[model samples]
Target: MSQTLTSDQKDALQEVTNIAMGQAASTLATILSTFVTISVPRINIPEVSEIGSAISKMVGNGKEVTAVRQSFAGHLRGEAIIIYGQEGCRDLADLMGYDEDIDQSAERELLLDIANVLIGACLNGIADILQTGLTFAPPSIMAERVIINSLIDPTQLTWNNALLVEVNFTLEARNFSCHLVTLMPEDSIERLKQAIDTFMENF
Candidate 1:
């Protein structure tokens, strides 16, 4: 895997997401009738093996997670996404008065609805500023015991290696913490730098 985004580039990334995440927080607050606090976005680019474990550690058990993937092409090119585990979703659901007795079977629909709201709000903010359009595959879930690689389609990857940028976030209602991860090609580093620089100029 190639580490293309340098420190400055990474900072630019976090800054861009800071604005988007705040927008997501606003979206959640209106729906749940509560405030949502977003932490400072941190940048993490992970290797193949590190991806699972690092992600596992971030969004531990007993939390609801929403994972989103959107490809970004421009001066800064890569996939931009958000991943929120069960914790925030459950808390938000509770706040919104959703059924508390959700089981494994019901999770399929539950997760899709959550992903639609959270990821949609986040990327909408991003696309508005970047003047970019993003495409998405339907969001799905792997059960509690499943490995991420097992569920992901292998054909989508161009190589054995991948570069992923992860930003940590905490939702305020009940202190739900999870990750927002973005993946991209090694060649996209330059584009990332340019995109960040552009965002910062306006910021």
Candidate 2:
């Protein structure tokens, strides 16, 4: 699981992720009736332990955050997480047209829907490009208003290396941001490489 991807492999993966996330962002924009922008996909291959630091930095500076996690299995199996910084819940509600105060139940519903849309759309887009099928479990709130340091446990996972693809999303007209992270195990990375190679050959 300590295997590293060559520069070529990393570049190919980044290309795939960029297209996938673009499709996802477009779908979100349509749903929200506003523009949605996503940062270029960033692919990092880091040691298992160092992953937490990367995730922590992405989660944000010392602010409280919200995390939603969903698991998928098929050609690729792993967790897809969306992290939000402080005031994220309120801002998202406002953007979604919640003109008044949002109750706790309403906030939870909004977060789940957002997580599902982002995670499902992004993963489905990736799966479609890879010509593969994937099934995802319902997304759950892993933490809300919690510090990033306590959000995830890298040691509890068995994978020795991970392909972490990060895509930052910003909603147009709102001061809100979220981080989308796709964590694929070593074997999943192998499957992805095979799929990418096949796709390139046919292109």
In model 1, what is the error at residue 126, expressed in angstroms? Answer: 5.0
Predicted structure 2: clash tally: 0
Give each model's clash number.
11, 0
Candidate 2, residue 89: CA error in Å?
2.6
* lDDT over C-alpha atoms for residue 36 of model 2: 85
Any residue pairs clashing in model 2, and if so which? none
Q: After superposition, how far is residue 136 of candidate 2 from its true place, in Å?
A: 1.0
Q: Pick the candidate with the highest TM-score.
A: 2
Tell me each candidate's TM-score.
0.66, 0.86
Q: How do the residues 103-141 of candidate 2 rate in per-residue lDDT, one tens digit apiece?
A: 777888878877888788777867886788899999998
- Model 1 agreement with the true structure over 1-203: per-residue lDDT tens digits: 45546777777666666777777777766755676777786656656556555555555533344554545454334554445554555765565556878564555565555555555555555555556666555555534433343324435553323333344444453776545555555555444456556876875
Candidate 2 deviation (Cα RMSD): 2.3
